[model samples]
Target: MTHRYLKNVVSLELDKDKCTGCGKCTEVCPHNVFIIENGLAEIIDRDRCMECGACANNCPFEAVTVEPGVGCAAAIIKGWLTGSEPSCDCSGGDSSSCC
Candidate 1:
């Protein structure tokens, strides 16, 4: 699947100190953004992230933190053309605010 969202737009922070190498993020990410290497979760495809916040939500140790939002480039362009700022409602703090 292809998305129009800008690459590297979403803020995804991984804290190695907090990460337990549980691999939950690997299991939840639909875009294969995370991989377990040597018992640690590493981001291998950050550009493919869709800001779904599934990894952040599923992290038991709160190792993954991301600011989820709609990074659609087309929407941003449309907003610029329409004289409005495009914003996503997803806060990425929890699953309830996910897009």
Candidate 2:
């Protein structure tokens, strides 16, 4: 009954190997998803992330990646109830019809 890859799993995964420690991802992230730990952007306060694609877009090194945005179960449920787009943006728009 669980929607795989359609659930709210907002967590920052830092690829330490790729992280150049540019600090760009940390700076633009409105949720403060990254931090400088040993000169690398460590995953800190991941729950605070809103998954707005800021981290992914801002990540110049392509080190950090996350399924950002709307981890709220209620919202996903509501979207389903109203035939709206699922939680993920794979549809390429804000509504289900766009999918």
Candidate 3:
């Protein structure tokens, strides 16, 4: 079997206009990906983000979204090998992993 190198890249996008200052996204994130400045969620650490999707799922106003998941290389590779579609936290209605 040929092995593929895993690259877990997570995108952190916040819709400032849609945010309602609920602070839910910042609360659910385990990797400390966001910070509140002027009552808005800011992307502080994109590299550290695990892609857990907690923020997107918890956001009440749907202001935040990600291709959510843990961003773990090994985990994603395993999922791919097993023929299961990888999951993301900000997947909207795709599926739930940690969010």
Best candidate according to lDDT: 1
Q: Which prediction has more favorable TM-score, 1 or 3?
A: 1
Per-candidate RMSD, Å: 7.4, 8.1, 9.3
Stretches of candidate 3 exceeding 4 Å from the true structure: 1-8, 70-82, 87-99
User: Model 2 over residues 1-99: C-alpha lDDT tens digits?
Assistant: 622343345656778999988999878887666788888878766666667778787887788787755656756876888798556454545455322
Worst 10 residues of 1 by lDDT: 89-98
Cα deviation in Å at residue 24, candidate 3? 1.0
**What overall lDDT goes with each candidate model?**
0.80, 0.71, 0.71
Best candidate according to TM-score: 1
Query: Candidate 3, clashing residue pairs?
Result: 50-70, 51-69, 53-89, 68-88, 68-89
Model 2 alpha-carbon drift over 4 Å, by segment: 1-9, 71-78, 81-84, 87-99
Q: Name the weakest run of 10 consecutive residues (lDDT summed) in model 2.
A: 2-11
Error of 3 at 75 (Å): 4.9
Candidate 1 stretches greater than 4 Å from native: 1-5, 71-99
Q: What C-alpha lDDT, on a 0 to 100 scale, does residue 41 get in candidate 1?
A: 93
Q: Write the per-residue lDDT of candidate 1 for residues 1-99, one digit (tens) a residue.
A: 566556666688899999989999999998888999999999987778877789999999999999775566655665677777655433435465424
**Candidate numbers, best lDDT first, in rank order:** 1, 2, 3
